[model samples]
Target: MSKSRIFLFLMLCFIGGVALRSLVFIGSFYLWFLFGVLTIAVFSFSRNRTALLYAALIAVTIAGALWYGRFVPEHLALERFVGQEAAREGSIVKDPEFKNTTQRLVVSFPEAPSERVLVVARRYPEFGYGDIVRVSGTLEKPEPFDGFNYSAYLAKDSVYFTVSFANVALVKEGSGFARGLFALKRKFEENINAALSSPQSAFANGVLLGDTSGISKELNDAFIATGMSHITALSGYNITVMLIFTHLLLAQLLLPRTVVFWASVGIVAAFVVMTGASPSVVRAALMGLALLLARHLGREGSVLHILVFAACAMIVVNPRILAFDVGFQLSFLAVLGLAYIAPWLEAKLKRIPEAFKLKESFVATVSAQAAVLPLLLYQFHQVSLIAPLTNVLVLPLMPFVMLFGFAVGALGFVSYHAALAVAYPLWLALSYQLGVIHYFSQFSYAQIAF
Candidate 1:
C-alpha cells in the first residue's frame, strides 16, 4: 500500500477504536483477547502484504481501545466522590467561565489530581486561574438533560463531577504563566468594555477572544437564530479567516511567501495566547498552522490528509474528545467540508459575482455550514432557515471586524482614549452586523425548533 493510504487507514482504525470505546464499554479482558486474536491473524497473514495490513489495522484499533480504557479508571475514581459533602483543596485550573450571575471554575484536587471538579460560585468575589481554593459542597455528577449527554460532554475535559453553590475560600492567589495570561485577557476585556457599549463591546469580546460572558441572552439568541454563533466560537473558521486575511494583506506588500507565512504564524500564535489558549482555540490554531504549512509547501492537494493527521494527532492526546467534545467535532467537520466540499461548491457558483471574492466567500460559508448542519440539527434540534443568506452577508465582514477589534484591543493597553478613537469604526461595523442579525432573526420562519 502507498504510504499515504497506509497512514490514513491506520488513523481511521485508531479513531474508530476511540469512538467505539467511547460509545460502548469494552472491558480489558475482551480487549486483550481481541489483541491476541489480531496477533495471530497478523502472523497468519504474513504471506500476503494486503492481508498483513488488514490484520495490523485490527491491532491498531485494539490499541486505541486500550488507550481510552486507560483513562476510564481516572473517571471512575472521580465518580466515587460524588454525593459526598467534602472540604477539598485544589487550584483553579482554568479561567472562570461566567454566565449570568454565576461563574464556573474547574478545580483540580491534589488528592485526585488527574480529575477535575466543576465549582459553581457566585460572580462576586471573583477568582482567577491557578488560585488554590478550599471548596466545601456536595459533589454531584453531571446529569444528562434534554437529550444532551452532559456527562460525556464534560468528560472531554476530564471533568466528571460538579460542586454547586460551593463555599469557596481562596487559600492562595495564583502567580505563574497561566495566571499572567488570564490577567492579560482580563485587561483586554476591560479595555474592550471601556471603549464600546454593552452589546457591541460584548460582541467584540466574543469574536476577538471567544469570551461570550458579556453578551446578553437576547443578542446571543439573535446570533444563534442567524446561524452566526460560530463566528464567536474561535473555531477553524475564524482562525482560517485571520490567517488568509493576514497572508493576502502581507502578500500585497510584496513580502516573500516565507516571510508572510512566519509573520502570519506569529500573529496566530499571539492570538491563541491572547485568547487564553482554550482547547477549541488551540485546536483551531493548530489546524490553521497546518494549512499555512501546506500552502507554503505548495501541497494543497494533500490538505485533507493533513487535516486527518492533525485531528488524529489531537485525538491521540485526548482520546475522549473524538466522541465527546462538540466543539472539536464541529471544528473538524467544518475543515473537512472546506477541503473536500468547497471546491465543488465554488465551481457550481460561477454565476455569482466574483467582486471582492464574493463567490469564493459564499462557497466557503455554505460548504462549512453544510458540513456541520447535520451535527447542528442533531445537537440543537433547531434549523436556521436564513442561515445561508445571513452567513454570506456577515462572513465577508468578519476579517475586517477581527482586524479592527484587535487594533482597538491593543490600543486599549496603551490608552483608553486612543482605543476609543479606533472603536468608533468597529462600533459601526458591529452595529451593521448586529442589525443584520436581529433584523433577520425577526422573520417568522427564521429558525425552527424540532
Candidate 2:
C-alpha cells in the first residue's frame, strides 16, 4: 500500500471508530463529524486518487449504515406498556434458570401486537434455555441511573421494555436456531464452570465464558476496587488468551497450513460458544479471526483495520447495538487504546526489563481506562485511584491463572485427584495475588470519588 493510502486508511478507521462510539453518548452527529472529516481529507489529499477514493468509500459506507440503522424496528417496545397490562407469549432465547437467584432471559415473541419487547423479569418461575413461555405482565421503560443511561443499554440489545410477570407459563418448546445456539452456549458454560471453582474462578469464568451467574456482589466489588473488574468480563484479555492458546496448540500439531487454519477457526468457534457468544465476545472473536487470517496471508495486519471491519459488520446487522451497547463500546475503546497509544508508550519504555519491557502494558491499561473512564465515572461516580498500580501488579499473573485453571478443569474430568494437584498450586498463587489486591485496596487513598 502507498504511504498516502495507508494514512488515509488509518484516518478513516480512527474516525469511523469514534463515530460508532459517539452514537451511544452524543448520537448521530458523530456520524456527521466523521463525514466532515472524510470530506476535508479527500479534498486536501486530492493528489492521490486511490487514497481519496478509499476515504470516500469508507465515509459513505459508515454514514449510510448509520442512517439505515435508525429506521430498523426497535427490538422491544417498553413505551406503550408503561403502567399498562399486557399478556404476551415469548420463548426464552437465553439460558433462563441458573444458580443465581436472579437471571436474565432474552425472550422472543411469536407475534407481538407491536414489535417484540426485551423484558428484564424479576422473581419469576424457574426457566432454562429454550423454554417457550407466555408472560402476562406490565411492561415499562427502564429509567436512567445516576450517571449511566438506560435507554442506550436497551437500544444496544434492541430491548425496549422491562416486564414484571404476574404469571409465566411454558408453551411449546423452542426449536431450530434458538435451541441450537442455547445448547451450544450451555455446554460452553458447563465446561468452564466444571473446570474452575471459587469466587475468583467464577469471575474468571465470566471473563472467559460470559458466565457471571456464579460471581457474587462482594467478589464483584473486590474486582472493582482493585480495577481488575475487566478480568471478570469478556474483553480483549479473553481474546488474546484464546489466540495465544490456539497458536500454541496448532504449532504442536504437524498439520498443513490449510488444515491448521480450519482447526484454528474451529477453536474460535468453540471459544465463542464456550463464552456465551455475547456481543463483545463475538466482536473479539471476529477480531481474533482477522488477526489469524492476516498472519496466514502474510499481510501486516493493522488493528485499526480489523476493528473497523468488525464494527461495520456488527452495526450493519444490528444498528441498535451502537445505541444501547456497553460491551460494544468497552470492547472497541479498549482495543483502540491498545492499538493507538500502547505502542508509543512501549517505545518510550524500552529500557525496562524484557519481562516488564512494555510498560506499554501499563500504558495499555491506562489508555483503556482513559477511553472508558468517562463512562465509568458516569455510571459509578467513583474511580479507583490505584487502578494503574493494581493492574500492573495483577495483570502479569492472569495468564497463569487462566492456563492453570483451564488445565485443572479439563483434567479434573479424567482424574479428580490429578486436577486437585494442579489446582492446589494455582489456588495458592491466586490467593497471594488476591491478598496483594486487598492490601493495596486498604490504603487510605486507594479510591477517590469523582
Candidate 3:
C-alpha cells in the first residue's frame, strides 16, 4: 500500500481503539496507551527519518494530552461542595445576573476557603458585569435527577458548589483576566435582547447568539419533539452558517487572502463571545477556524481529522467532560455525521432535481439522528417517526427564515414599524412551520416510546 493509505489506516485503527477503550473504561489512560502503541508501530514501519520524527512528535503530543486529562479537578471534590457554606468573596465568571422570578449566577472564588470551589449562586445580587461580591450563602452541591447527574454537569463546567439566594451578597467589583470576557458577554446579551422582540426572533437570537433565555418552554418542547432543538443553540450549524457568510462577504469585497483569513478569525471570535463561549461553541469555533486555515493555505484538510483533533484537545482539557456533557457529545457527533455521512448521501442522491436536493438536509438529519438515537432513547425514551420528513420540509426554509428574522429583528431594534413590517412575513412563515410540526406530532404514531 501507498504511504498515505498506510498512514490513514493507522489513524483509523487508533481512533477506533481509542473509542473502544473509552467505552470500556471511564478515563483517558487506556486511550493514551493505545495512542502510544499506534505511534510506535507507525514509526517502526516507516523507513524515512522524517516520517519517524513525525511519529515521535505525535507520541509526545498524545503523552501530553494524557497527562492533561489526568490533571482535571476530581469528581469527589466536586461532590463534596454540596451544602457547604458559601464564600463571601466570589466573582462572576459567566454572564450577568439576569432576573427571573429567581436569579442564577455562575461564579468562581478567587481564593478558595476550600480547595474544591465552584458555585451556582441562586439569589438576587446587585451583581452586573464584572461585579465581585462577598457572598454569605451556604454552598450546596447540586442534586441529580431523573437519571441525569446535575453534579456531573456542573463539574464539567468546573462548578463544584451552588449557593442558595439567602447566602449571597455583593461585596465589590471583580478585577483581572476574566472581567473583560464577562463584560463582552454582557454586551452581547444586551444586543441580542434589544434586537429580538417576537418569539421567532427570540429563537433566531438563541440560535445565533446562544441567548435562549427568551425562548418559551412550549416552543422549546416543540423543537425537542421535532428533532430540531439544535437549531436553538450555537452548534455546528451556526458555525457553518457563520463560515459561509464570512466567505461570501469576503469573496464579494476582493479582499487579500490574509485579510480574509483575519476577518474569518474575527467573526469566529465575535461569535464565541456572543454565544457565551460554551464548550460546544468553542469546539465548533476551533473546528471552523481550522477549516479556514486549511482553505487559506491551499491545503486540503480532512474534516474528520480536524474534528478528531478538536475532540482530543477538548478532552485533554477536561476528560470528565466526555462523561458528563450531553451537549458536547451531541454537537461533536452531529458535526461528524454531517462531515462524513452527509457528503456520501448527497453524492449518491445527486441525480435528483436541484429543488428536491433536500437530499443534503435529509442526510444531515438522518446522520445526526443515527449518532444520537441511542442517547435520545435513553434520555427521552421516545423516537420520532416523522423526523426525516419534518427536517426536509422545514430545512429548505431555514436559511431564509434565519436571514430575514435577523434582519427584521435588527430593524425592530431601531424602528418598531419597520421591524414589524419585515417581522410579520417571517413570523407568518415560522408560525406555519411550527403548526406543521405540531400537526405531525399529534399524529397517532408520530412517535414511539420504549
In model 1, which residue pairs have backbone atoms overlapping below 3 Å? none
**Between candidates 2 and 3, which one is better according to lDDT?**
2
Selected candidate, larger TM-score, 1 vs 3? 1
- The TM-score-based order of candidates, best leading, equals 1, 2, 3
Give the whole-model CA lDDT for all candidates, comma-separated: 0.83, 0.62, 0.60
Model 3, 229-302: lDDT tens per residue?
65665665556544534554566688988888898788667657644575567876776566566557765545
lDDT of 1 by residue, 25-90 (tens): 889899999888888877877799888888888888988999988777644666777889989899
Q: Which 10 consecutive positions of candidate 2 have the poorest summed lDDT? A: 355-364
Candidate 1 accuracy as lDDT = 0.83
lDDT of 2: 0.62
When summed lDDT is taken over every stretch of 10 residues in candidate 1, the lowest stretch is: 356-365
Candidate 2 residues 80-152, lDDT tens each? 5578887877777655535465556667676553344555555446666667777777877767877567765
Error of 1 at 78 (Å): 4.9
Report the number of the highest-TM-score candidate: 1
RMSD of each: 2.1, 5.5, 5.5
lDDT of 2 at 314: 75
- lDDT pick, better of 1 and 2: 1
